[model samples]
Target: MAKIGFIGMGNMGKAILQGALKEFPKTDFVFCAKTEATKLRVHEKTGIDYADSNAECANRCKYLILAIKPQFYEEVLNAVRYMLTPDHVIISLAPGRTIDQLKLNLGNDKRIVRVMPNTPAMIGEGMTGISCRKEEFTDEELDVLTRIFSSCGKAEYIEERLMDAVVCASGSSPAFVYMFIEALADGAVRCGMPRKQAYIFAAQAVKGAASMVLETGEHPGVLKDQVCSPAGTTIAGVAALEETGFRNAVLKGCEAVYKKCIEI
Candidate 1:
């Protein structure tokens, strides 16, 4: 019998599978894809097992990851409801779905965990936010779930109320970061750098800068000051960013994402 089963094999689902496989090499995993093409693709790529249907997947695993889109949650959960037992834990990756809503579809006493994980998980550097009631899960069960998340990157348990914020901060922020990298590369190209080389330079600089923040344990402002010498070129660039209201723009973008997540 599989220890865990996933109900989707999309990008995020595949990323989570890659991570979990590394952490649980001895554990059997099964996934139920919507089509035979995807089912064959996932199994061939990852060497993991596949189930013919959602109910079959649910029946074979103790932990079922509901990785399908929010729109399909009702159908998927309804299909698997009769197979779910009290011992099963439902780990949901849909953004707007809540534990309570899941219980209404599955069972009132069902254990559920809602999580937000980003695309970076494809590279084993994902940031995931998880929410679960302490009483709903045993300590060992929680640890296994957390380890599955951490295998890709970082995982933190947060209050369900803050899940929307997590969506804004990490779930949707990778797109914004990619935009910034593209803009930086464009600027370099404008200054006579080769287009391909420009992207490498911009991407590495962003990666290194982010590493410093995680490793230094200092305020970002202080780190900025460290880079900006008196009347230096860095200060000139900082002035331009300030004049363009870069920080405000990012904050407003996050606010917009948070608003949209709540709507969903």
Candidate 2:
């Protein structure tokens, strides 16, 4: 039996699995994809085993990641709930599936951990937010969970009440960041830069700026001020962005994500 099992080999599932593979032995991981071909392909690519069904995965593994969509939670949990044991730790990546709801599905005794991790896990730069009752998980179990997530990126445990905010802030913010990068590239292209070079320039700038925020611990506003001199070109661009409601647009996008998260 593997130590970690993924029931759905979707994008997010594969991301987390790949990240874990870097930290754990391949033999310690197993997954069940939607089809035999996919299972075989993933097994071939990653050298990880595959279970024939969700129940088999649950029966064989101690830690299970239910990587399926939130809508499928009830169906999948119903299929394997009986296979779950007291020692089994079920990790959920979907938003709005609270610990109480999972407990209702898998019985009150089962341990459930809710996680919100972004797609950037694919590149070892993901940000993950985990939520669970401290009393429910022992120090060793929490440490294991933290290590698993931190293998790919940063992980923090927060109150469940803040999970919806995390869903918008990190889980869905990547899309917004990508859009901003695309806009930056488009502006560069309009100024006669080649599309390919424009993308590289735009992406690297965004990456550098993000690194500065993380490494320097400076306020973003202060960073902006540092870049903008008296009546400088950067200040003019910032004024244009403010005039066109760039910040408000990002806020609205985050609001939409938060609404949909609770709706799910």
Candidate 3:
């Protein structure tokens, strides 16, 4: 039997599988999809096995990961409900689906973990937020789960109550970051730089700035201050951004995402 099973083979699912394969090449994986074409495509891409149905996949693996859309959660869970047991650790990727809601679908005692993973998992630099009840998982189990997620990128355990915030801060922030990068590149293009080169510069700058924050363990504000020397070009740009309410815009964007997550 496979050690892990994925009920959906979507982009995020594929990304997680890619990361896991890198760390556990010998571990077997089984995936289930709604169609034969998808199964064949995923097999060709990852060289992993496929199951005929959700229950078959769930039964074949100790770790069951539900990567399907939130709207389909009920149907998928019901399909595999009979196969879920105490030994199975169900990991959910859908945002806004709380552990309580998942337990309602399965049993109240089902072992479940809720995770919020961003799109960067595709490149192995994703940030994921995980939440689970202490009673549902042992330390070793949690560590194993963390390893699976950290294989793609960083994984941190967070309180379930703060999950909506995580969705805003990490899950949906990548889109906002990409927008910022595009805007930066557009500014460079306006200054006569080639579009492709502008994108390269803007993207690398963002990546390096983020790395500095992580590696240096310094506050972002302090780092920003360092870049904004007296009467310098960076300070001038910062002042322009402040005048245009750049920080406020980012805060509002995050608020909007958090609101939508709550609604979901």
Best-matching candidate per lDDT? 1
TM-score of each: 0.97, 0.98, 0.97
**Mind giving the per-residue lDDT tens digits that candidate 2 earns over 1-264?**
789989998988988888888788988887888889999989889888898899999999989999998778788989898999989989998898899988987899999999999999889999999998889888988988998888888899999999999988899999999999999999999999999999999999999999999999999999989999998999999999999999999999999999998888
TM-score of 1: 0.97
Candidate 1 weakest ten by summed lDDT: 21-30
Q: Please, what's the RMSD in Å of model 2?
A: 1.0
> What's the TM for model 2?
0.98
Which portions of model 1 miss their true places by more than 4 Å?
A: none
The digit string of per-residue lDDT tens for model 1 on 69-163 reads 87888799889999999899899998877889878877898898999999999999999999999787889999999989999999999999999
Poorest stretch of ten by lDDT in candidate 3: 22-31
Model 1's lDDT to the true fold?
Answer: 0.92
